[model samples]
Target: MNQHPAARLTWYAVLLVLALVFSFPLYWMAVNSLQPLFTGMTWFPVRPTLENFRLAFTLQPYWTFFRNSCILALISVGIPIFTSFFSAFAFARLKAKLKGVLFMVILSTMMIPPTVTQIPQLVLFKQYGLLGTYWPWIIGGLGGSPFIIFLYRQFFMNVPKELDEAARIDGCSTFAIIWRIYMPISIPVVATAAIMSFNTSWGGDYLAPFMFLQERQYPLSTQLMQVGYILPSSPNVDLFQVKQAALLIFVLPILIVFLFGQRFLISGIMTGAIKS
Candidate 1:
């Protein structure tokens, strides 16, 4: 009906406004990144320049930061993919004693704030002399992510058990049933886990690395925090512009990844929701 079209238009207008509102910080960051630091910034830059980008690289060892983050994210994601998948498969397909109790304990952990365990984990790492190395990040990833395990378990539970039975009859082992039968079809959920895990690992908060890594090994997120208080040692440059440029550069990888992964994210969440 004509009325339906008008109503839909009104909803679209409302949603667009909400979207713009939420996106304002990113818009501001982009605007600031292009503005000259000495211009004192406006809603939009009167004179846009790539000078800030040039300064951003000169001001810090940005290449090192990018590399470190990539290493951390890849390791973090890789460990979870295989470990969480098998853990989920076990929880979903295998019969075991006290399964419900063990699972409840794991789920209970999500209720406890991460801050509460941060100190204990830090102390434990320090005791093992892992404080200043990538071991902490690697070890933490290998420890198993309960959230991802839960996601996998949920999605795995949604699959038909008949698949397992059929695979077994065809001389497949437990691992084969998972790798051959379940995994091939679990693309959506797996993608969701990988994307979400990478995002969590790549979050702008550099505090985790800040606490563990030495100054030279600090990531861009940590370096950017220090940038605010200490402008580049050079006296002749614009400070604000460099900070904005760094913000833009620092966020680009995650932004690019999310853009490419968004379709998978949507489909994966939809597929997983069929069970949960």
Candidate 2:
């Protein structure tokens, strides 16, 4: 079953090349953020400074943007995860006449582009006087993500039905079964949902915040796009360089989450895939 040594070497060589290609932008960003402002691009900087980091905060209300981002991310991730867990459990464990049909309908929603709904949603929010508040984002997440529910349902269905029967015989309530048994074993799935949701909420949906919220309420994702970082003392500094610095900080949390939870994310997906 083993491949020839030359073939294995070639495969690894290809992977190494691809890895470098994919990672080069991150490397370039780091290099650019530290390099002297307005200098020509180089593989490495000769006189890097921490001044860009300082400028990133001073030029704007970066901390306020950061706090807003965190608040929205938490709301965006939490409500859906909580709601999805139970909804997934119903699809996975309960028997109903139209369960499959219902699940398919929910799955179909995933194919609907968010862009198609934006105008209608914006009007709805405005009619409700929800614009300029966090309610637009909050209400959007209450339905939970179909994809996360699908992930949870797949993982839940893979568990033997006998376990549920056993718990029932021991007088475990339905809620108890989920809390004491399913949740403990589904750590990987939880981590997977969390990382996915966090990324989407934290940086993915700029249009929602931009359209619905005030300028002061903008998150890091939206605020980073503002074109007023030029300092009077250092008007020569490239705006792109300042953004690079802010972007590095902007991306750091997502990077850290994935780096640590990638193992769980892979495990959750693979486990779900094995059964369905």
Candidate 3:
């Protein structure tokens, strides 16, 4: 049943090429980050240096941005996960009127463009005096995404109903049953959701933070725009290199989280997909 040697070698060659092609952007980021002060767009650096990275921190309050991102990410991820778990448990197990219709409506919202409600949400938050503060971001975290809820719902459905019965026999509440039994066995899905939430709430998110937070409260992502501090006194500096350095720094934490949780993430998605 094994393929011929030449065919297998050709397959591997194709895979290698695809991998390199997909990785080119990240490779470019690394190359640019380590590039010397004056290099422009390049496939390879003639004299790679650490100065770009050195300046990435000096040009901005990179650590403060990092700290704010961590806080926002944690708050955003935590609230959604907590809410989604209970909501999913209810949908998957507990009987309710119009449950399927409600679930469908939730899923349907994903088809609508988020921008449609952006102004309305902005006006509502402003009325509450949350404009130009982190409160709006924190408040927005309360509404769990439908996709995450669906993932947990699928995973919850796969758990044995007998567990719930046994928990009930022991006088445990439905919430207790979920926390004690289902969640313990759902580590993969939990990790997958956590990683997804963290990544979504982290870098590359300009809209929500930009609307709610001032420049002083900006995360590393927004701070990247004010990259003018890299060489304020010098007009002839290659800003492309400095911006690339900021981009790499902004991406590193999520990259680390993904690498660490990749196994769990894949397994969880696969399990949820199959179960649903």
Candidate 4:
């Protein structure tokens, strides 16, 4: 069943258009970040400079925010991945009577909107005297997240029970079985959860760290908002270029993560699609 040349050409055209549509914003950001401030708005930058990037770091503690964001993302993703791996393995392999019910309760949490819990969470953190600290974000991640657990459980379910039985017969404890057998096979799903968790904690703008931390302790996203978007302009400041440069910095880490882990990310996504 060979396709006609005209039909293939049309499909290629459609894909090319979609690619351009998705890529234009990123392209524009890169271009504008290099442009001179207060210049006329254009699709392409006329004259470019690195001054905006220089000014961005000079105006604020950009490296501090970057390090803080990396720490937060690492903690947030690392906690969920290891915890969810074990929880998912237990739920998928160990046939306990209450397993179904417990899994249902976990799934139920996903139905509730996070916004509804924000005030209560804020008060709870405040009561614990953990406000203006990293504790809130760290604690949230340390608890195995409902969504990541679900993802891992689904993937684990697709694994053959025979492997678990074999490992058990070989005198492997539950943790050993999970570590020596399932974990190796579960790399795709783990990568998926890691990428998702990292992005969620890295890019999230509300609650968690935001409500718990003050100005100096703010995450990269919040700091970007404050210094890049909300701050009042001084008479001598070139606000436009500064803001553009800040936006560029904000997106850089995410782009790097995606570029580096794209293969693993794709494998993770496809692993879930496999049927038992």
- The lDDT per prediction is 0.80, 0.89, 0.82, 0.80
Q: Which lDDT value does model 3 have at 241?
A: 79
TM-score of each: 0.93, 0.94, 0.92, 0.91
Better of 1 and 2 by lDDT: 2
TM-score of 1: 0.93
- TM-score, cand. 3: 0.92
State the RMSD for candidate 1: 2.3
Query: lDDT value for candidate 4?
Result: 0.80
lDDT order, best first, reads 2, 3, 1, 4
lDDT of 1 by residue, 106-129 (tens): 888889976687789889999999
Off by over 4 Å in 1: 1-3, 228-238
Query: By TM-score, highest first, what's the ranking?
Result: 2, 1, 3, 4
- Runs in model 2 with CA error above 4 Å? 232-238
Give the alpha carbon lDDT tens digit for every residue of 88-195 in model 2: 999999888999999999999999998899899889989989989999777777888999999999999899999999999999999999999999999999999999
Residue-level lDDT for 218 in candidate 2? 91
Model 1 scores a C-alpha lDDT of: 0.80
Q: Model 1 misses residue 276 by how many Å?
A: 9.0
Tens digits of per-residue lDDT, candidate 4, 173-229, equal: 988987798888888788878877778888884455667788777778888765563
lDDT of 3 by residue, 1-276 (tens): 399999999999999999999889999988877777666778887788778777777777778888878878888788888788888888999999999999999899889876788889889988888887767756666777788899999998887788889889999987788778988888999899999988888965667776777777777766676434446787565467777887887888988999999999999999898852
- Which candidate, 2 or 3, would have the higher lDDT against the true structure? 2
